[model samples]
Target: MPQHFLLSAEARNLSPIAIARMSEYEAVMTMKKLRWGEGKDVICPRCGKKHEAYYIKSRKQWQCKECNYRFSVTAGTLFAHHKLPLRDILFACSLYVNAAKGISALQIARDLNVQYKTAFVLLHKIKEALKVHKQRETMQLSGVVHMDATYVHSSQKPKNKKSERVDRRLKQHENPLKRAILVIRDSFAKQDDEQNTKQIGARNTIAFIAKSENSKVVNQLANKHITKGSTIHTDESPAYDNLIYFHDLKRVNHQKEYRSDAGVTNNLAESYFSRFKRMYYGQVHKMNNTYLYEYANEIAYREDTRRLSNGVIFNDVVSKCLTSLPSDDWRGYWQGNKKRVETLAA
Candidate 1:
């Protein structure tokens, strides 16, 4: 698809608010309805031939007449091979994406009334889905791209046995088990030609969970999505000092001045992190690195779709979940939804 057309199509479909209010079962059923026979014969997986298929809503499966093949709607998709009711999965995804910070597995289990392990596994699956979607897109964070980092605690830390050098090192940096999230924000130009300042436009976020605050990591991320010569804004963290090596880097020393000649700052990204920290600290409390990135993507995805109505968000997430690639598992589907959310915001 042409980039603009694909983007516009996604924009028309993107909505986060709607998804928040939906029950998991309803979302799954709705997705099943959209993917089922819409005046077209179901293609037989075994023969690759179009077959007459009838929907058995009770079982949520399709029975083919020509081949006598019966398959559940979730058979080939991520929803297949799961023992959890479709409703619980859908609800988990809804809760997962809607929260600004994140929902812990225990909380998810409580809300869905499932086991903690079930909730944990479900969250991991959805996160894996989000990761697949991230790999599919090419980001062009043109205009002003704000960059910054925030810390999130890991789920577990090794016990200290003795004069523990590693433990001491970790404590020196405000907890060694904490992971840093590097985020980038796109700043749009505001009206008023006289001010000539970049106004905040639609906001989107890309988060990386890293151990060390290093320029190499920042540049690696920049090279992936940002175009050459694009204006980049960041605080005077030594790690970001080398950004000029790649893009049009501009710096604001938070220790001194907060703005530069570009009249832009990393405040946008910082504001996002503040919201993230509140949720991470207040609601969920703790998360491991494995799940931290997923939660970050979920939060970012919701923020991108905050303006849309609840119904729109629900439909968009379902649609993106259906069409996303790599692994069609639950995690892949959510990741795909996140990618679509980011693209629409862009």
Candidate 2:
């Protein structure tokens, strides 16, 4: 529970040389070392066969002596089809993993010296890898827990004269904005986790960006993320009424009192909501629902790993980048993709 040891100035695994390599060609070698291992058999991504491959220096690619399929160091993976340098990719990973509150795409663009569009895609790609790897992890909340649903306003605004006129027409309907999110965090969730312990603590959370907070949706979220027989503290929203069937539901009526007889409250949800909202307003001023949900997942991931060192997080994200597949789901995220965000989803 002490401040994550790895983030301390002396505890970080990143060295001056490594940081220097992040801006040089050595970062590509670092990627290859982490992804394929040093001095090992070359495995063809296309054929899944081991062959002695030769480096085609002119192309900055590899040639499988067997299939003759030529590829760059980042091909056939999450970083495929990228136009940026290899070191810059690793540089972005370092910035993202250690960012406690969260970093903006604009900030990322400035750091990488790339266009906003490239940074947008790059940040999401890293988040997508982290998200894919996190989904493989099984987390269940137990003991006292807090659950709540809140609507966050979108940051999208008009950029041109024509769009400005259209925004004026729709201003009346943008009150509650685009998405509703559900946050599930343990009330006694730890601000930090014990590194050697195997238990997933209360502060750990799972969330979803939802469209509707109906009975079935709320019930399904409760059933999936929370343990079978735990206490659920929430406000008097009717959306949570159906949760009584399984959870020991405790309600706090904000209109009259903040706490009930047994010290029941949704304080954790309020705190988390404030932080997430702040992150949204400060870092991501304009975002669509799919990426917003991805941002929520990033917040949860940050909290869950808060107790660990930044070095640990950096290594974890690097591993995810090498192993996880590229996400095709980001199509139209900022370009008018209006499909309903996942429902009854964890």
Query: Model 1 Cα displacement at 79 (Å)?
Result: 1.7
lDDT for predicted candidate 2 compared with the true structure: 0.74
TM-score of 1: 0.72
Model 2 TM-score? Answer: 0.77
Model 1, 200-250: lDDT tens digits are: 454567777777567878878888767778888887788877779768888
Tens-digit lDDT track of model 2 for 94-146: 88876677889899899878888778878888878877877897878887888
lDDT of each: 0.64, 0.74
Error of 2 at 82 (Å): 1.7
Q: On a 0 to 100 scale, what is the lDDT of residue 31 in model 2?
A: 73
Q: In candidate 2, how many Å is residue 329 off?
A: 4.7
The candidate that wins on lDDT is 2
TM per model?
Answer: 0.72, 0.77
